[model samples]
Target: MKALLMLLPLTLASCMAGPDAATRAATAPQADAAVTISSTTLSRQHWQLRDAVDGSNRRLDALLGLPDKPLQLDFSADRISVSNACNRISGSYRIVEGHLVTTQLLQTRMACADPTLTQRDTTITTVLQGGPTLILSSAGHTPLLTLADANGRTLTFAGMPAADAHPGDDGDTAPQQP
Candidate 1:
């Protein structure tokens, strides 16, 4: 009886120490797993804001511009730099499964009354609360960044900026540094 009781505690402890099979299957691949994405991989992935139905409004518009030049995304150990046609924006980013969270974004403050950029920023910040799948697609004239779900459905949002402006139009619109 004493030996059985001791074994029971050991079994329980082991079970509690790490994820179970189901948990592992459901969770995002960790940094080590082959499924994990490297900075190079993430930079290469095509992503777009969710659609208007999913809050793809003014903010998403301002963040991305016409694809005249391929948008340059420099992914670092903990931060991201995107060279939109008008401005250079940098922020901290994290990925879970297929979802990405960008925080504390600091953009070069140039005067563009284009409401879309402001709105796009707001939308991006708000939608981070809702999980969205990150998909990279290059089928269109511009690279398409699809924010979808596990089932591969793009979340519909509102207020996409017209493909008029460049992202790096701000005073700091220079080539990004290494």
Candidate 2:
């Protein structure tokens, strides 16, 4: 009975030391699994911000812009564009090794009269300037784009169908990026 008690503690200690072999294997790609994501994959999709939270997981609805308008992110061949209630923001962007690398964002000079709108611009800049990890998941009906920024904020965006995203578009015309 004493030997069994001693072994129980040892087993628990080993489990607590770190992840088990199975856990490590699950995190890594298997022989047949392909994991590389091409930057162009995002170019065809339109994304709208659905949730924003800081490191503490506090809801930052202020970054959401006005209730009537959505804060949108559009990916182009070599640019990342952000459209909000107040300004049009764009920057050169690249998805390097699963991280979002970008030049400093360039936004229009228009001054927003609304305080929340102004704050939204600043908040978006904060989360995007630092290289963030980009994760795209298509498990749900609508695809999801998650950005985990260096400031520890997680921004979750829901994918919109290109056709649905630009309802007014004639098939021959495409939206221009900032």
Candidate 3:
């Protein structure tokens, strides 16, 4: 029958519609558990840049320049502080729908004469301003943080316990040399 043939396609389409709201709701608890695990992992650590890639997926090592000191990120209950070689940047951040959104970012005004340091700092600020999606995972025994922007650029970081982060209590002064 012609009517039956037409209805057959409609039925098949509905079958391919994927999981409905009820099914998603039923599995939300599991998803929430995973998110909680990830949040705990990230919150307990301080992270440092491992590598960076541009929107074209090209490695940005040349542009980033050689680091004279470790670049770092420290996360607290409400703020993130960044030490990008020569300058310090801080901002408030919140996790929403599994994404880290940074707001009210502030950076030190100290002028750096080194072009390389200035360029690297500018790139870091630009990436942070884009509100990249955060992905936390582990490789071997090391924790990794990957921040991917909407344009496909990614910055990967390796993390250590917050207690081991460099610089002093204020995250501005370098540790005094013996």
Candidate 4:
């Protein structure tokens, strides 16, 4: 009876070891259906912010303010730089399982007189710091990068091809003129 009890625990442990090979194989195709965005794909362009939404509210126009300088996110091999109109934000980012994860953000300490620009800066930093999941897709001929936050806020950007990317620059530099 003692030997049987010991064997029973071992059996239960094995059962709790998670999905077996057969189960994994059955779901392999479904998992593969989620196309992973490669570093090459991400690094191949400069992404310009097209629109931003906070919950159900459209915040792009307000974020852009007067004269309308577009916000830009540039991704290199391991770093991300954001041109948030007035101040620049830089960070390290990684893609895992088709999601972009950002960390170690460093932003310039420039003070803006305009309250709207200040608010926009705060909003951009908040969204980036949230480590939103990126959805990489295409709209017609344009490549799109969508950062979706946990609170349902989303920022969408349009990608300009590597050929059209800024001359004499990679994405590592903070605040390159747009």
TM-score, predicted candidate 2 vs. hidden true structure: 0.72
Please give the distance, in angstroms, between residue 170's alpha carbon in candidate 3 and its true position after superposition: 24
| Preferred candidate (lDDT higher): 1 or 4 | 4
Task: Provide the overall lDDT of each model, using Cα atoms, as 2-decimal numbers.
Answer: 0.49, 0.75, 0.70, 0.74
Show how many residue pairs clash in every candidate, following the order shown.
32, 0, 0, 0
Relative to the true structure, candidate 4 reaches a TM of 0.67
Best TM-score among the predictions, by candidate number: 2
lDDT of 2 by residue, 29-102 (tens): 44323434444556656778888899999988787757567778888768989887478889998888788888
lDDT of 1: 0.49
What would the per-residue lDDT of candidate 1 be over residues 1-178, giving only the tens digit for each residue? 9999989988998888656766877785333232334344444333333343433333333444443433344555567665442445778888876676778667776665655555544444444434566554333344445555433334332222233433333333334322
lDDT of candidate 1 at residue 20, scale 0 to 100: 78
lDDT of 3 by residue, 1-178 (tens): 9999999989987877656756878776332234332344555677878888988989987435665454677787678788765578888887776677889689888898877667667776777777777777667777788887887788888887766444344433322333
The parts of candidate 4 lying over 4 Å away from their true place are: 1-34, 57-60, 66-68, 164-178
Candidate 4, 1-178: lDDT as tens digits: 9999989988988887666866878875343344456665677778888878878766756675654567778888799888755578888888875567789688888989977677667777888888788787778767888888888888888988766455334334332334
Clashing pairs in 4: none
Each prediction's RMSD over C-alphas, in Å, is 11.8, 7.3, 8.4, 9.0
